[model samples]
Target: MGALADNRRFWLACNLVTLVLHAFGVYLYASEGFAHPVAQLWAIVLMLHMLEFPLAFIAVRERRIGWGVTIMATLIFGFTWWVPTRRGVFHA
Candidate 1:
């Protein structure tokens, strides 16, 4: 699983899926609100992602990444973005 995670294609697919989920979550939350179980779940997931920001901040600082990009990517992809980034797997 660790080896699979190092693949760029794998990360790309993961990020895309994450992006789609977030988009769907936003739409659902806006339309149906937390009254829907799925929307509530997505809201919880989003909150969890927000909680991950401090960790992302620490990991990304050493790489000289700008705060805005780091925050957005971490919120969107969580470990999918930060883990590979910290491991230098995204580089040649």
Candidate 2:
């Protein structure tokens, strides 16, 4: 395959790792009944972090979206969506 395709596949694999890691972390927290400091907050943040990529793009495309929001989202979602969609479109 081409370089772009290869690069995307690599990032997709990394995204999968991110998803699994966050899920595992959340699972550990849940197992403890979320008694630790900000465990609930961690769960919420990590889960949202996983979706931040796709959501950022959606935010950018919306007509009513603000530049500030888009910029912040882009910054937060950097490389998470950047690699997979580097070609101006994503494979999946």
Candidate 3:
């Protein structure tokens, strides 16, 4: 039980960090612009965030919706930061 709680806390912390980084990436992209692939990837990630709303609703009604939102949120957060950095969006 203690291990599970710790794992959840770790994941939550990771999620929060990812969210903040993703927000920073969005700001950087808007202000500085990004390459085609980076822009496309960010757009897709934003779309996934939007898509999670409906899934979240479903999850509210069904306990077994499979943590899809949590997973996608984490992925979007990581991918957004990685794609931009890899594409030299922040090369200054």
> Per-residue lDDT for 1-92 in model 2, tens only?
36755575676676676566556666768777677655675666555765665656563463445556555534444455544443444532
**After best superposition, candidate 3 residue 32: deviation in angstroms?**
1.7
lDDT of each: 0.81, 0.56, 0.50
lDDT of 2 at 74: 42
Query: Comparing candidate 1 with candidate 2, which one achieves the higher TM-score?
Result: 1
RMSD of each: 2.1, 7.3, 12.2
| C-alpha lDDT of residue 67 in model 2 | 52
Per-model TM against the reference: 0.83, 0.43, 0.44
**What is the C-alpha lDDT profile of model 3 across 1-92, one tens digit per residue?**
44533454454565576566567667768876775455555667677666555444443333333455445543565433222223333221
For candidate 2, the lDDT comes to: 0.56
In model 3, where do residues sit more than 4 Å from their true spots? 1-6, 36-40, 62-92
TM-score of model 3 (CA atoms): 0.44
Q: Candidate 3: minimum summed lDDT over ten consecutive residues — where?
A: 83-92
Question: Which candidate's TM-score is highest?
Answer: 1
